[model samples]
Target: MYKVPKLNNQGTEGLEYLYIDSNGNIETSKDHSKLINDPDGVLGNTLKPLLKLPTSMPKDFGFITYNDQPPPDDKGVTPSVNSKFGHSKGLVMMDKTTGVWLLHSVPKFPFKRDNNFYPTSGAAKAQTFICVTFKYAEFQKIGQHLLDIAAFPFESHFPADFHDQLKKAAIIKWNNREPGEKIQDLESDAGTQFKSIAKKLYKGKMSACWLESEDLT
Candidate 1:
């Protein structure tokens, strides 16, 4: 079994549950009710503004069980993946805008990748990845909202056509293609298009740690 990490809120420590299985998947659990009443107090008021939506009774929420076993001797040490906690059975919150009843269990992991990895040729053995269960309606709504925000900038400075182009450029970048590949595979004009729009919309206003700030910059 994996150990549960301590959660701190304004110098107070809260109870948390850890569910781990033999295959190396780990998840943290917390009471959804506590989170709803004290969302700002818990997350240091960081997510208060973004969580403007009203709290609702979670139709579905619980912990996911999974195996947490390390790879065999020949496989070597696998890099750690970050953990995220939430009220929903899945790590994702039901509503991105106003779901204060959810708690996130973010872990310090060495690798930066989605929590899905399958052992291939080099591994000594095979392992099964755990899929988190969630309510259909809640998942769809949150997923769509996030897609809209990530694909299209909410700012008014960029035109609709420019936003669409920027979304395409972002998709290209997400695929980890080289500049030349992006140009050939995606929009041939992607090169100057994203640059021009980005320069105009975010002139001297971008920061590496935007989430750390009190307000959107």
Candidate 2:
């Protein structure tokens, strides 16, 4: 079953969904997180209506790139696996100290530094894009959870040895076991300090889809 619920912490709220049974087993379910895996369904239901946006793109937001943050030395030192993840398919906002998951969006270019917005492709109609935000102290757990289910063909399984190795790596990530990275970096892997951008983009007109019905883009 796919569930879309508003998770609240303090007075703020975030969009959270899962594929699970009453016992909280995600894989046993038939859908297996299908709602978010493919199409944009929550737009008319819980998300599009209640979505909020920031007045401006917060300074804390940045793309998690594949480029080595700090370039190598003159002798051309080798880079680690984590240092080359610049496939800028998405953007994020993070603040590790207090842990704020705020506005997150695939904003068009000129808004995000050196990032361009994706345009509608060949189809009968347009499409919608969205993102979610959350906050918590258990940042590592959230990261592992997302990684476990972040792939396609959701029902696929790996061999015993490979699965065991992956689980071990996940545990190491949860336990802050990195050779050349800091705890903050690992923690931010969960996007603990990201914000949403519903209000910033649509303001009070989310349902309108546009400024006026007669005016088409």
Candidate 3:
């Protein structure tokens, strides 16, 4: 099993859960109960102002989510397609300076863009995630990586002047595209350096090193 680092209020450089309180205060908390949880089986309509672009982002911003399983409508009818396409699930939100990419294993989540509710369906099982904060320039490579994986954006919004790769990623539809990979050395704003190997339909070795703490427990 992998060890998770201890979280604290001043800890912004390592693994930490971003929790927004009802008062719109963004804080890092180890208490799961303090985090928002939706016990009712319904999509929340409450708008999280804390997640607004002008509030959370330093400047102009945009976001997009790619998932194979579309959220069921109010009538409980799921949208269907003629062909089987991408199956990746993730969300990428960014601004002119920085961005957040959340890669998750949850399906039928994020039913709407206005709310920040965690679905009951996703809570049934332990979901895995790889959330990273990267500089705006790195998003260009990230957009290209999504295209290589043929991730279909079920929901997306971005400025016209933003990276062209991001626009292309928002409209991915075909699954017959050739497989590819893009390797890059990336450095976070916090000075953490790492290499990323994005692959599609290929077998390869995956490795990463986190030197933030000597003891990950």
TM-score for each candidate, following the candidate numbering: 0.19, 0.23, 0.63
**Relative to the unseen true structure, what is the C-alpha lDDT of residue 90 in candidate 2, on a scale of 0 to 100?**
30
lDDT of 3: 0.60
Predicted candidate 2 versus true structure: per-residue lDDT over 32-132, tens digit per residue: 43233222433222222112233233433211211212223235453342421221223222333223222222212112121111112111122223334
Q: Which stretches of candidate 3 lie over 4 Å from their true place?
A: 1-32, 35-59, 73-77, 81-84, 174-178, 202-217
Compose the digit string of candidate 1's lDDT tens values, residues 1-217.
1222233443323223344543566554353322212333333232333332222223232111111122222244542312211111112322322222222222211011112121222122211212232333333333332232222111111122322332332241333322111111111111211110111112255566734657765
- Model 2 segments more than 4 A misplaced: 1-92, 97-115, 120-125, 136-138, 150-217
| Ranking of candidates on TM-score, top first | 3, 2, 1
Instruction: Record all residue pairs in model 3 with backbone atoms less than 3 Å apart, i.e. clashing.
Output: none
lDDT of 3 by residue, 121-147 (tens): 554444455556789998888887777
Candidate 1 yields a Cα-based lDDT of: 0.25
Q: What is the lDDT of residue 111 in candidate 2?
A: 21
The global Cα lDDT (0 to 1) of model 2 is 0.27
Error of 2 at 31 (Å): 37
